[model samples]
Target: MSDAAAYACDNVSTPVEAVQAVLARDDLTPAQKQEIAQGFSARGLEFDVSEQVCVDQG
Candidate 1:
């Protein structure tokens, strides 16, 4: 999913908050979780939760 959507899923803000959400999840693998963690290690990144984005109908 998009970064905003991922953050929205857990109602979080900032990379640290995003990582905390990832750690709390149970549907992903260690490597997948690690990759997400790495992505958040630096700034300017959009998380890849892989969930479908909800586009506007209007």
Candidate 2:
């Protein structure tokens, strides 16, 4: 099985989880990451690591 496929099967239970798992892998190239991200987008899941999810309120 491909690394992406294996990662998706073993780690992802939701769209966010899928994106997080793919982004965390060092084994995949930029192209591979884009492909995985596109796959997730096609299924109505979108992820952008540049967007901040947590902010300091202080």
Candidate 3:
């Protein structure tokens, strides 16, 4: 991995943060995002996508 990628991997504290980082990228399509999200789901990781949970926080 590149230095930046290695640094990010080292510093990331949770699976949800890594998943959110991937989801936030503009390059991924809906299908790709869903596939990745499903993988996280299998591992019991997720973002609270509800407006009350996410909208006010950011």
**TM-score, every prediction:** 0.43, 0.46, 0.50
lDDT of each: 0.66, 0.66, 0.66
* Ten contiguous residues with the weakest lDDT in model 1: 44-53
Q: Model 3: clashing residue pairs?
A: none
Clash count, predicted structure 3:
0
Top lDDT model: 2
- Candidate 1: regions farther than 4 A off: 1-13, 43-58
**Which of the numbered candidates is closest to the native, going by highest TM-score?**
3
Give the per-residue lDDT of model 2 (tens digit) for 1-58. 9999888776556757757877768787766776776666745357543322577899
lDDT of 1 by residue, 1-58 (tens): 9988887656545556757787568788767877876667655545544443478999
What is the model-wide C-alpha lDDT for candidate 1? Answer: 0.66
Q: Which candidate order results from sorting by TM-score in descending order? A: 3, 2, 1
Which structure is stronger by TM-score: 2 or 3?
3
| Candidate 3 local lDDT, 1-58, one digit each (tens) | 8999888677756766778888777787767877777777743345432112335655
